[model samples]
Target chain A: MFLQKKFKEYYSRAEIGMPRRFTRREYGFMFFERQMMLRHISFSSSQKLRNFLTEKAPAHVFYSSAYYSKPYEKEMKDKEWLGADLIFDLDADHLALPENCTYERMLGIVKNETKKLLDDFLIRDFGFDDLEVVFSGSRGYHIHIYDREVLELGSRERREIVDYVTGNGVSIELMLGKDNYAVPSVSEPGWYGRIGRAIGSYTDRILSMDDEERKKELKNVKGVGDVRAERIYEGLKRLKKEPRAVNALPKEFIEHLKDRVAIESSRGEADEPVTSDIHRLIRLPTSLHGKTGFLVKPLTLEEFDDFDPLQDAVVFGDEKVSVNVLKPFSIRIKDFSCNAEEGIVEMPEYAAVFACARGFCAEE
Target chain B: MQPTILAKYPFLPEAFDLVKDESMDEILHSPAFNRARELGVARVQRALKNEDSFLFIDERNCFDVVLSFFISKAIVSQMNDSFLLRRHAIFEAKNAYHYLEEESRETADAVARSLGIKRDRNGVSFVTFLKYSPNAYGQWKLANSRLSGGMVEVDDHTFLRLVQEAVRERVEGIKFSVDGLEKTLDLGPIRAELANRKVTHRADRVELESFPPCMKSIMAQIENSINVPHQGRFSLVAFLNGIGMKEEDIMKIMAPIPDFDDRMTRYQVEHITGKEYSTPSCDTMRTYSLCFEPDGLCARIKHPMQYYEYRLHVSSKKV
Candidate 1:
């Protein structure tokens, strides 16, 4: 109940602007006490949206990436899909991080991944310029692309885009020259060039290591034995200098290296199902996340480079509040870091809201 | 464009416009259109026979070629068989590609643009490539193809191939009214040929090991007495009947369902076979979300029967 009041207060003060074609988008909400979502709703103007926000104070807000001819229709076929903005969601939960990874560290890792997706794939390769990035209010980032060419793509075509970024089905044997001996040229386009460059860097990394480490690394590759590793180590310099020397190593070694290079050169790990789903509803930017009380903030590419969610997304002011800490928890927000144990503690309003909402502490 | 070129490529918009206002009665029964009518029947027969022979184009015969193409379309609409429609579309598109290879780049580009393929300063848009890439091989997939500045960079040959794909889809969707055709030409021989093609028996030896993964999964579900969804049950029954399973055998295979009634199951099985319904294509199965656990072979073929046929051929080659 207190969280709902605080959320309502935030909505009252915040100047939340509307998304593009806001009236055409299907909006969905989950109120503070309700578990089921009230979806397929539309707004006519920013004032109407604001009035609803201030009055209802929904705990979670979402809008569809797709535009429809009839947004109010309950049935999918009746909706008559016009087009959709391509969406790529990169969540830290989907990444293969260490078990004890901290939230801050996880965000940092996902930030780099999102950067690679933006610069390497979307910008450099696909040439998509009309894209926006949002801090997902927790755990990750979302990239929304409003490019005209990608608007009417169906699910299979969208999956092909996913396959390209993820480097699915890239075959090393196909990249070989006529003799099947020479490696792909660095000047080649698409995955060929990317994989070729990755191979060069991986060779350099292997050569920079000490003798024992080098042999261990070579043998660590799946199809390479000790003898094959020794042969590869001897031929490493030749392989780096002359691309055709790739065939000097065991065939299995080159095949395995190609698979590794394909992985290393892939754009980034994007959540596949999200991009393929045309009717996906994403978290509305500038809305406060119910669980963490952090704003789902939008950022420019420059602002996103240095943005810290724990500090920047804290919307509440520094009014002091008393909270009963039911469990030990640590949080750092707005220069106030709490390493509270199970006891009563005085904290600022933002910290109190974050704690109570997270179920670590409660208002006294 | 010259009439001679339009005659060669009757699938083009100019050809359609030229023949659009012509009287169907004259085209079907007029002494002036006797040669056109014969050529049109020959075109449909060639497609039904799965032969991709091209019709010769001459400046003198421009009108006949344009009229014949639409007449062939009318015959296709009169028959109204999905399999024959697909075969005819593919045959015509292949023949178009053969002619397109020798045409000037400007002519080919215009045809492609008319079919909704956009080409700006930056090669063809990725949207065009993706929309037409489904039936293409893996190498032609958007992932494998080269893209720059939001466009797919293609050589002239690849561009026409993309145009060929577009033409196939366009022609496959073309339907003409044959409301008054019964009073005109006798289409009995063509109808008999289609019926004969339909009843050509499969090998008595069924290859259970060669079934597509979707059908295999549905079979497993039914054998375990699990309640398969309506789409799954329909696809499974259609596929089994398509692969030459006996009606009684299909009923036996379906008997393990929890709600199976002997008479009802037999009737439904007979209905599928009696209607001669071909198994739904892979795309349709995917739209219904019934394509489950696709194997490597599934990626190469567009239909369930193709999967079975390819597997059967491979196993026979091994023997």
Candidate 2:
């Protein structure tokens, strides 16, 4: 009887204030719609009263006046802990009431105004065909999407969708009407279309092909030599288009192509191998079997000059010999038939021992 | 008149009483008084006759003479107490040693200066103490304060000689001698000598006997093991035949074998074989086999049965 009376009063108010285009049932409580309507009641009401209203006329409650109450204030402290689907706290201060109103009256007015604003915003901007609001037991109301698919989306992607709805910088136009904001179409070429859209199209094309065809095209494509680049291209293409009928290629071949493509692309135009004239001299240990340990004997200046009468040589310590005190006399002994082309140097064991000893002693 | 009578008459009761009271002289008979006066005059006459009469009158006993002698003669013996005797002697000895030490330091410094060797303060003291502090003998002379005759002293030379003997004995306890050995022989030269000696023994059958039987057997095993692979690959039967042992006999000698997996190549087998045998599987097999089981024949052989069993076990366990 009380619910019938309340409905009659709300109905009379709706008839006078709401547009006549809405159906009588739309303005009144349908069986499922009651849950959403009763949720707007002020929290100061007794639990018995709330239960009674909710049991018969279950309405979506929006708790928008948490600023005035200490309990509600404490509950909304950790915005993250609320697990709210959509938090509307950014511009909550604009919903505050005048000082003359009592707490319950102020809350009621704010709740009604906020609910109307939310309904209008959702319908006009986002075109949400179905939405339900619930009191957050704190500052803002939670807007839940009962659709499972929307909930199944990854957290990051869901955040992106939420950002788009909230009119973030890149997606602001999505929330505005055609008169207020215009989104550029992909059909006309712009900076985004040329670079971003073109890459996306190219990726779609590559991913649409079979593995064998893809490999052939990859192999034929010039400058696609490095593996990482090829893998990235393949990934972008796969993301853009559906899989083709071709079987999965062997991992080794795919990896090989990817590596090659990465290397080629990274190298760019400079493809030739580097060349140098400087040669490295590797000093090998003297060994008996190689004839590298017994051929050239280290001799003093006097001995060297006497042996080779054509040139005068002077010994400098143990390792060096100078001819005429200026130009040094150089000799390289070859091992195994004395072949200079082989770069084999033979040194007498006794001369090596003497040289090593003399080198160490001279350093000290 | 008599020496005994004179000694007793000095301490007599009647004389003591007469001295105590002037009226007591009337009690003394005239004869007694005359006798006493004569004795007294005689004593005075004796004193006037001798120039050394005071010395005789003040003569001391042996104990008093000894005490005075010790007090006057000894350097640090001022008190007669036996407890202080050792401490006084020690103090006097320390003082003497310190004086000698300082004097020696000065002398050493002068000598070093003359020789043109730099002498710092510490260096001078080090040399002085090094010389005067008993040398390495660990003995030194100390004064004896208890003696009454003269200043205490010790024979330092005799003490030093005894210390030297003790030290010599200790040194001799662990002495070693190498007779007829050249001190200048280099280890390198010894190695060269050994190499030359080894070459000489190569042809000597008697020298071969110097190697123990176990060493000879190991050498033979190593030689045979290496030679078998070089000769050619032998079948199970052929290998047994070459070794003059049947399969069962060979297995009996080397049984209760552990299984290996197929992944374990012949190189692994050869590795456990200590390079005594080589397998065609891989170059590292001999080395691997040597690491696990160097002594076993199975380490050298790649048993197909064991490999299969190991593989089966591994696959089952994995499953």
Candidate 3:
């Protein structure tokens, strides 16, 4: 139920429009996994439990999972040795913990003990909006703030960010010190508007749903808020209907619409009978056989090239046949070119039909 | 023996024959010979004036050939088989003048102190020369263990002045003073007897089987003061100064063979202390010593052979 609520919330907030469909199975799985991952209350679950986070409070999180396993062992030995809470197929060479503790009672004793550092130092210096948190699902949380504006930043810049946040010359243990979580202020340009735009776009999707969908989705999606669902629904609706109006749309949207139309049309025609074109006639090449010529009904290019009408039929008098009163058909008297060059001759079925329906061809 | 002719004039044997008709004494005292001596002296004086531009003085050819024979032999004798000096030439008579001047100053102060002479002026002249000279090729060879020709030259007077200043500073700046101190200190006769008497029964015992009482107390103090354990049971010398007893003395007393010859093992040190002594590995010791020397005193014991080699190697190749 929690997963279903989460999925509905996600659906309401998501910006996909134009009758984009989801299988019931996929929706159910996503909801179930998210709920199970966030079941435990710890600093690492901050991302999972972000809906319950209070405004402006700082929190530290760590991401951890068991890295390896053997058939004999239920869990990895190193994971157990390190007291890891979850196991995953990822490297766990280094263990990290966050400096600040937020929402002490729910997170755990470790977080409660580390809360003062978050409140006194990090919160005091770095404003509440400067802090962002993500759940790592297993042992830790990833904390990020979209506030750096370095252009074309590379891997080195990421390391520089780590160094700046941790403070120069500060050891990992010192950065995660129980007494202090506040890092010194690093003078750097702030984050670009591009990052804010991305966040704004996602937030809009989550908040676009109408009231009925929003309420239903919110109940299912644990973290989805009403505002996000409304935004998402509105965005989706705008995306779906706006291009059909007089206004021009982006090429991508046009393509998306075309694909949607094709899918719908194909579904509508599923029960129709299959038929070949009657007006179109395909020509084929000649075929031959030893001591006799045999005419073959051509099906494809290869058969058409192999069939030789002149060689397959013996030369004889020409005749005319009529298929209907308005249409007449002509044929030449011919003998069978196969079977020891026997003189047995036959005309095509079209000629016979023409003779029955109308008069014969006129002599010329 | 016939009067020895110092100027054989080997390159011009005929010149010597033409000049040899006169008595040896007459030639030796002749104005011509005196003129030659004056020419030699002038040549040396001119070189000394331009010594700053020369790498060496050919004392053998320049001084010995025409200058007074007595001065050349004196300079040559002082230089014996010291290979570094053998490769360089000296201004024998000129250097003798300087050496005598230095000796006179030393004698003057000694006489003044002994006889209580209150002369206002000591009349001692300090001669200074400005010159550039190369170190001998052999000196370079000794330093690098390879033959090389490039040598550093310095103004001898300036070098001596720097040396004097450095010595004065070092002597003045040293914190510990051994002045007026007696050479010997009394130790209990029991310890002396233990050191002198040959104890044959303990020959098979390990060198660090036990520590002296004084060393044991010092080890305990070190252990308590620093959280780290002592490296090993040590001698009284190590306990006092954090260095082992001098190797030469150990060899003289104990006559330890191939195994214990002045180099004590970690196990042996631990055996003596009756305590677990955990010494950092040699590499760790080196790293810690380099990092923490200015901040903290390193408490690692070094092998005497290693210490001696370091000192010898550094001194021989000192920049």
- Most TM-score-accurate candidate: 1
Evaluate chain B of model 3: give its TM-score. Answer: 0.17
Q: Could you tell me the TM-score of candidate 2?
A: 0.14
Off by over 4 Å in 2: A1-113, A124-130, A137-140, A170-364, B1-319
**Fnat for each model:** 0.38, 0.00, 0.00
Q: What is the DockQ of each candidate?
A: 0.26, 0.00, 0.01
The sequence of per-residue lDDT tens digits that candidate 1 reaches over residues A109-180 is 999999999887888778898889999988999999988878887655677788778876565665664566
- Candidate 1 local lDDT, B195-282, one digit each (tens): 8876764436679999999899889999999977655777888888788776777888898986565644664565455445678899
lDDT of 1 at A168: 68
Could you tell which candidate, 1 or 3, scores higher by lDDT?
1
- Cα RMSD for predicted model 3: 38.7
lDDT of 2 at A76: 26
True-structure lDDT of candidate 2: 0.27
If candidate 1 were superposed on the true structure by all CA atoms, what would the RMSD be?
Answer: 7.2
Tens digits of per-residue lDDT, candidate 3, B127-148, equal 1000111110121111111101
TM-score of chain A of each: 0.94, 0.21, 0.19
